[model samples]
Target chain A: MKPAAFKYIAAESLAQALALKAEYGDEAKWLAGGQSLVPAMNLRVAQPAVLIDLNPIEGMAGLTVKEKPTSEPHALVIKAMTRYRTLERSAEIATHCPLLHETMPHVAHPQIRNRGTLGGNLAHADPASELPAVMMVLNAKFKAQSVRGERWIAARDFFYTLFTTALAADELLTEIAIPLQPDTPTARTRTCFMEIARRRGDYAMMGVAASVTLDANGVCTDAQLGYLNAGDTPILATQAAQSLVGQSISAAQIQAAAAIARDEVQPPGNVHATVAFQRHLATVLTKRTLTTILDFRF
Target chain B: MLCKDFSLRFEMTDVTQKRCFVLFVIKMSQTTCPPKLLQIQNLKSKIPMSDLHTITATVNGKSYTRTIESRMLLSDFIRHELGLTGTHVGCEYGVCGACTILYDNHPTRSCLTLAVQANGHRLETVEGLAVSPTQLHPLQQAFHEAHGLQCGYCTPGILMTMKAFLAENPHPSEAEVREALSGNLCRCTGYQHIVDAVLNVKDEG
Candidate 1:
C-alpha cells in the first residue's frame, strides 16, 4: 500500500519546472494539484524519478475571457489554466455557456474539483473526460510552452489517441481559447451536455456535447457535436453535424444525426459499459442532448 | 525472480469442508516490510540521509513531526508513524474511500496523498472524533446506537466520510447519504447499519 521511493521538489516557478523537466527529460513530471498524478503514482503505473510540484508556481491558475481572432459568434477565447472550481463557481459561464457548466460538475467530486486543473485534465487527455469533449465542441485552441518556445494546437488535432496529445514531453499547457457566442436576437444558439455513468465521480460510459446554431429562418446554420468515451480520442460528430446543418430541427433529423454518431464512434469495451450498450447510449444521449438544446425557448 | 520456499501446515481437506465462512475472516498479521535496514558494507554506497525525511503537520488539534521514508504515504503517517491507526489503508490506488481524511476541511484519500503533501495542511483523522480521548462524536455515537459496524476495518473511514458529509448537508435524506457514501465500500453489515448510522445523525440534529 506504499509507493516506491522518488525525489520531490516544489518548483519555484514555471521556468524552473520546465528547466527541471528539460534536465530530467521523461524522468521528471510536473505535479499540479495531484488529482490525477498522485493516483497514478500510488498505483505505480507512472514512476518518475523526480516530481516538480507546480503548486508553488505563481499566476498559473485562473479563468479569463479573452478576445477571439474573428468576429464570428462561435469564436470564443478562454484561458486554459482555469480551475474547474473557478468555472463551476462562475455565474457568467453558467448563464452564457451552460454546456461548460453542466459538464463541470460531472468531472469528479467537489474536493477533486478544488485541486484539479483544466490544463492538467486536458493534458492528461482521457478520452472520456468532459473538458476534452467540451473543448472539441468549442474548437478550442491550446497554447503549449516549454523552456524554448510556444505553439498553438487546435483541439481537433491536439488529442491524437488515448492518453495521448500533441504536447511534447517537456512542454506545458499554458492556455485554451474558446470562441464566444452571445445569445442575441440575431443568432439563436443552443447547447446541451449529457452523459451516463455507472456511478457518480466515475468516468462516463457515454457522453455527448451538442452546440446548435440556427438562422432567423429556423434553418440550422451550424452544428458541432462532440462524443466522449466513444472513441480513441474526443471525436467531433462530423456526420451528425452535417446531417443537421441547413435543416429544420426535426425528430427525424435528430435521429439521423444520432445514428450517424453511433455508427461513427468505435467505443472500447470497459467494465462501466459495453461497446454495444455504449453505442446505444450514445444514440439515446445524442438525441436527448439535441432535444434539450432545441427545446430552449430563447 | 528470486526463489523462496516456506511450509504451511493445515488439514485442507477437513478445514475446507467444515466452513467456507471462516476462511474469509482469517486475519493475517504478517508485516510486508523488512524488519531492519541492513547496510551493504561491500557495495559502493552514496550515503543517504541518516534519518528519513521529516514531515510536520497538525493532526486533529495536535502538531507533530515524524521522520518518514520518501515512499511513506499520508495514511502511513497517520497510522504507523503517529500511532493514530484509525485511518485504514485500502485500495491504495485511491479508488476506495477507506483512507479518506479531512485535509483542511476537504475530503482526500490519505493513501494517495504523500506525507510531505500535508506539511502545512490541517488533517483531521477518525481519531479526531470526540473532544477528549474518551468521548464519542455524534457520528461515532450514532454508529454504536445503530449497530453500524460488524468487522470494523471500514468503520473509521465510514465515520470520517459521514462526518464530512453531515457537516456539508446536516439533514441529508437516506438517498443522499447513499449517494455520498458510494465511494466508500463496506463489505459487512450489508450497509444497512451504516445507512442507519448516518440517518441517526440527521435525526439527532
Candidate 2:
C-alpha cells in the first residue's frame, strides 16, 4: 500500500533540523538515512505530517580517530552519521578494533549498510539487533545535540526500554565515541560477537558479545558480557561478568558464567523463539562467545 | 466523547513544486463525511499536476525519465515508468528479491525505496541484463541453459542479484552464491538450478 501524502524538507544544517523538530513536535520526524523510517512510513506504522530530511545537513557525517597523549591509549572515534559501509571500508576499524570490523559485515547487507547510519541503527534500538548490544559491551558514548544544548549519554544509560532512548525529541545524535581497547604489554584483551538467526543476515533471535581482560598471571581482571533479545533492552549479565573476573578462563568458570547468564535473562517469546529456548540459547551463545574470546581466535 | 471526534490537520507541500495544500481527516471510523475532506479532495483535483516526479536514470545503456506519482515505488517506477517490465514485484515489503535492482552500482531492493529517493541516483534494472535487445546476458543465458527458472517470476531479481555478486567475487564457491542470494525467494524452483546457473555464469568469459 502507498503511504499517505506528506511534506518533505531537506535541512541544510543541524540547527534547522532541531528547529523543525521542535516546531512540529510529534507530528514531525527527522529523516536520517531513512533505512527504518521509510519502511515504517510505507507500512503506515508511522505517518509524520512533516519529515525533516537531514541527509544534506553539513558536518553531520564523518569519521576520525584521536590518539591520546604518547603515554595513554588512543581513542577511535566514529561519527554518528557515518554509514556502516564507511566503517566496513575504514582501515582504522580493521586495525584498531578487528572485532567490530568482523561484526559490521554481518549487519543486514551491503546495500542497507551503504545508507544505514550508526546513529540510526542505535536509535532504532531493536531488541534483536546486534549493534546496540555491541555498543553496550564496548562502552561507547553517544553525543547528542538539540536547539537548546548538547549532552553525552553513556551507552549503558542511553537504552531505557524497548525502542525507547534517553534522547529528547529535538536532539540529534551527532557522534559515537568508542575508547580504544587498551593494548597492554603482557596480557591482551580477547573479544567476540555471535548471533543465532533463523535465516542468514536476518535479525538475530539471540546474540551475545563478550570481552575478557586477562592479567599477566593469566587471571581475568575484567569481563564484559551483553545479550540481545533477552530483555526490554540489551542487558549486561553482571553476575556472569563477576563470575569470570579475577578467575582464570577455565571450563568450570565459563560454565558457571553461562549458567548465571541463562538465569539472569528473561527474553520475550516472539515469533522467532520460545522463552525457554531463548534462555537456553543465551547460555549456549554466552559459552561460545567466551570460548571464542579466550582462544584469541574470535 | 470529544477524544473520539478529534481530528488533526496538516499541510503537505510538493517537494519539486512549492505548492501547498491543507488536509484534514478524522482518525476514528465514525465518519459522517467531514466537510474538510471534500475541500481537500477538490483542491487536489484543481491543480494542473505535472509528472515532474518522473525520474531520469540510465537503465543499462539507455537514459529515460517519465512522470511518476510520489507514492510510486522504485520497483514500479522501473517496470511501468520506463516501459521495461522485466522486473517483477513479489512480497513488496523488501523481503522478496523480485524487485531487486542495481541501485548506485549495488544490488538494492527497489520495492523498499521510494521513486523520489532515486531522483539523481544511477539505477540498473533487469532490462539491463542483456548484451543487446536480442541477446541475453551471461547470467540470463546460464539460467536458461540450466533450466534455472520455472514460473520465472523471480528470475529477473535473481539475475540482477547474481550480476552484482559476481562483480565483487568473480570466483565465489557454491556456498558463497547461496549466501549472496538468500534475500531473494523463489517458490517454483527449489533454488538448486539457480545456484548452478550462478556457478556456470561465473565461468563465462
Among all candidates shown, the one with the greatest TM-score? 2
Question: Could you tell me every candidate's TM-score relative to the true structure?
Answer: 0.83, 0.85
Per-candidate alpha-carbon RMSD to the true structure: 9.8, 8.2
Report chain A TM-scores, every model: 0.94, 0.95
Interface DockQ per candidate: 0.15, 0.14
- lDDT tens per residue, model 1, B19-126: 011111111235342211111111113323222567789999899987777667788888888999889987675556788888887677787677877887799998
Candidate 1: global Cα-lDDT? 0.74
Tens-place lDDT per residue, model 1, A1-298, is 3455567777888788888877765556677767777776675545556667777677887665554455654543454456677788887678767788888878876556656788889988778788899999987889988898889999889887656678877888888877678766557778888888766766777889999989888888899989888776887889889889989889988998999999988886554467899899989999998988887644
> For model 2, how does the per-residue alpha-carbon lDDT over A37-84 read when each residue is reduced to its tens digit?
666566555555666777767787777788889675676787777888
Mark the regions of model 2 whose C-alpha exceeds 4 Å error after superposition.
A70-72, B1-56, B61-69
Best by DockQ: 1
Q: Per-residue lDDT for A291 in model 2?
A: 88
Q: After superposing candidate 1, which stretches have Cα over 4 Å from the reference?
A: A66-86, B1-52, B173-175, B189-193
Cα error, candidate 2, residue A121 (Å): 0.7
